[model samples]
Target: MKFDAILDPDSSPHEVCELGLLAESYGLNAVWTSNYPSSRDPFINLCPLALASSRIRLGPLVVTPYEMHPYKIAKALASLNELCGGRANILTGGPTGVNATMGMDFSRMVGRTRECVEILKRANPDEALNYEGNIYQVRGYKPTWATDEPPFIYIGANKKQMTHMATGIADGLMLGDTTERRLGSSLRLIEDNLATHGRSRDDLAVSCLIAWHVKEDKKLSSSEAKRHLALRGMLDIWFLETFLDAEECKIVDANRANIFTAYKQKTDVIEGVPDAIVDKLVENLSMSGDYDDIDGHIETLKRYRDMGLDEVAFKLHEDQAAAISVIGERILPAFQSH
Candidate 1:
């Protein structure tokens, strides 16, 4: 399986370009810039990286068709791929971030994502014109100058219907913040869906985005993990019940505002929930701690490989180069064939 990295769009273009060079030198398969509603434009931010790097694949992590039209997405992705000589990728998904803040109704996410994928696939072919999908329509639209090396399309999916449809349609699937226990059953459903399409597990690539926070100081690593817990989508009753106790879950549920405040501010202070609770959640939801934690992280990743994952894109933060170093030296080697 391949290993990749995801960077927040907060990084400057120079920083991203430097990180891209580091990632390529370290032999990372891909470097994805996340598309946050509040952050810098990911595609524009990643341009320097796409221009600087020769081998590592580059693209925005997950773009919503609801926020950006599929036609525009195709053009943007095609442009990036052209810059990379066809080493670009894109993860299409349902509503997220600014979409929710903008009060965008994405009730038809399944059909929308499917149509987006179809449009992307058709865009790759030379003869793409005059096709109409329920959610997206193309009327004799063709980018004749578009490169033949179409970016691999991956759909961000978590639940059942979307998972089945995305895996069956896109080139691959990307799961966000999914833990091992959750991954076991999700892969089975995806594999079964692949079979229904006359495809096998080998045909459908699977990958998950996991938070990585290994630091020299264990406390610093844990703090970084806590800062991003809200992104884990753990507010639901069922998800909270998994690692949190009843009263603890209730406490977290009650302080949803506080958590959102901290998340929005990008602070490490987790009000209502105890630091211990935060640490536990961090440990379970992300890979953290110091050098001694390497063994455990490898074991966790091994479980993912066993479950049929093709990659794990580790979402990184502060001291990212150092984090990439540790991963390059530790995690990548563990998964690489000697």
Candidate 2:
């Protein structure tokens, strides 16, 4: 299992760079800039990181196709990869509701992503690229410098069709809204789809993004985990529900109903949630505990490795420095040794 730090949208560009440097020092595999409405331009923010770190790979955890044309994304990534001496990655995703907050249309997001990826693959670092697709067209497109080939393209997908397309095209797949118990099922789905297309698991690199909060104080960890769940749960209710077993989903469904009911009644959901309830939510959805007591977390990752995962990117829900240090000092070492 490799560790990567996720840049918070609230963090400034300089702060993100600082976190990137700290993550590198802590032996993290990569630093991923998130593309959200509130986030700084990912490419702009990551340029400083490229200048600061010699080896740590940097790229967007996701750059949606709705926000920018594929040609521009390819150019940005190519430039970054050249600057970093070929240590760049591009994680592309379809549009989300969040994009609507930025006034972007989500209707054709997936189609646009598919079209963009096709165009991106045809692009070489310095060679002229001429592409024509339903959503994008580029004529005489090329990179100026020649240091390395284009960065590998990975797709962040969940649906069957998208997963199948990604398996056939992308170098890697990024899984989001994952839990230990749900991972196996997701992998099985992907494997079945790949087999139907006459492809094997070896042809794809699978990486999952899992939520985690590590702290010395168990109470603090539990509280943070609940807040994290509430925020993510609100954004991706159905996706989060997919992680729970039937019995667990029943519990979550009941809680979710109650939470929404309270909102309707003008009650504060956070105030209504007791610590015990929060802890239960944490146990069901996230990896939370002291950094030293991460044996269970390591075991969960081992299960993912057995399920054909190439890497696991921990999406930390705390201060950037703390997350990097804990993952580097505790999580990475434990997994590497195991």
Candidate 3:
């Protein structure tokens, strides 16, 4: 399996470029930044990294069509791709993050996501798009300047309908913040669909987003985990069910607001939720802990490899340089195919 680095949206352009350069040297396949309402514009933020790095691919993740039109997405990606010499990639899907960060609703998410992804897949800088879909329509403007190639499009999905759509049409499926067993289950769903639709697994890359926090100071590591733990799939019961029991899941479900409070307040003190539950969430949902725990992380990542993951996008939190060094020296070597 290949390894990739995913940066939180809060990371500056300089940090992203520096990490992209480092990742290129480490033989990481791609670099991605989170897309949210309050963060820097994805296209502009990635420009520095795209120019600085020769080998590492770069793009944004889970960019919703609801927030911006699909045509605009295509245009932005095409421009970014030209800068990167066609090493751009994207995970297009619904307003999953936008709903929380920007107050947009996901009432008809599946259909909207399908149209967005379909439009992205058809994005070509060489020719004009006269495409028409229920949710989107593009006419009279063919992108004309990209000399290399269009970005590789991946459909970011979790549920059944979107997974089926992604497996059939998109180049890959980007699953965010899922556990090993659930990943296997989700893959089975996609694989079955691939066979049914006569699509080859060779053409599609399956990647997952893992929140990473491996600091030399164990306390700092755990604290970072707790600080970011609320973002773990937004305490969705389906994700939490993999680890939490019925009553515990209810308790967590009830305390969902508190998780958001912790994240929004930028405080680790989750007032309503118990510390044990918070810690448990961090333990199961993320790649958390100190440097000594990296071996364990490698082991868990190997499980993902064995289960047929093409890439693992480790989303870095704090002490990012240190995290990058460890990944370059240890994790990348373990997964290198020789």
Per candidate, the number of residue pairs that clash is 0, 0, 1
- Which runs of model 2 end up more than 4 angstroms from their true locations? 196-198, 231-278
Q: Please report, as a residue range, the 10-residue window in candidate 3 with the lowest summed lDDT.
A: 94-103
What is candidate 1's lDDT per residue for 72-187, written digit by digit as tens?
A: 88888988888888999898888888687677986899988898888888875467566688877887777888855778889988888898898678888998777676788788
Worst 10 residues of 2 by lDDT: 263-272
Q: Please give the lDDT score for candidate 1.
A: 0.83
After superposing candidate 3 on the true structure, give the runs of residues whose Cα lies further than 4 Å from its correct spot. Answer: 100-103
For candidate 3, the TM-score is 0.95
Clashing pairs in 3: 128-142
lDDT for model 2: 0.73
TM-score for candidate 2: 0.86
Q: For each candidate, what TM-score against the reference? A: 0.95, 0.86, 0.95
> C-alpha displacement of 262 in model 3, angstroms?
1.5
Over 85-194, each residue of candidate 3 has an lDDT whose tens digit, in order, gives: 98999888767567777677777777777887777767666677787988789886666676677688888878898888888888878888997778999988988989
